[model samples]
Target: AQSVSQHNHHVILSEAASLELGCNYSYGGTVNLFWYVQYPGQHLQLLLKYFSGDPLVKGIKGFEAEFIKSKFSFNLRKPSVQWSDTAEYFCAVMPGYSSASKIIFGSGTRLSIRP
Candidate 1:
């Protein structure tokens, strides 16, 4: 089945440190891209997205990512991350193949921030 994968199962970072996450997917056609971040006990928020048009997209909380169509990859990056930025991150893709189609989530990267 088509799916997204988060290479990092866990990440540890100090305050004001850099963060780079690996994301990949297996799909045959057009799709929508997204990165969702879930803070402790908090709802998931859109970190970034790639619909159509440009391959590069910016997201909230000072996050950015580049979509490589050929590689079937969309990796999230942050030059410097805060303690609050530490959370589980997931990558999803909507193939638009079905109205009932659901977004597939990566296993998630549980990020920890240290002071």
Candidate 2:
């Protein structure tokens, strides 16, 4: 079965610190990768995504992710962290080569940033 995995269950850091969240997927075919963020009390928003062409994609708020097809990984990274960056990060994968494929989201990684 196709699935997404986020290695970090919870991450803690101070302001200005760097952040990296590991994500991996299980599938043998083409897929669309996405990183979604849900703030403390806000709805889930797309942070970044990788479909085709360039494997590297940059999203809003200085967030970026790299799609390494060989390892089936799409890790999220940020140069600096802020208190407002505290949120739940979810790595989602849409199996198949089409845009209408079903999306499977990872359990989630809760980020805590202290000022």
Candidate number of the best lDDT: 2
| Most TM-score-accurate candidate | 2
Model 2 steric clash total: 0
Global CA lDDT of candidate 2, please? 0.93
Q: Which ten residues in a row have the lowest lDDT in candidate 1?
A: 93-102
lDDT of 2 by residue, 30-100 (tens): 89899999999899999988889899899999999999999999999999999999999999999866657
Q: Which ten residues in a row have the lowest lDDT in candidate 2?
A: 94-103
RMSD of each: 1.2, 1.1
TM-score of 2: 0.95
Using all chains and alpha carbons, the TM-scores for the candidates as numbered come to: 0.93, 0.95
Q: Candidate 1, 74: how far from true, in Å?
A: 0.5
In order, what lDDT does every prediction score?
A: 0.89, 0.93
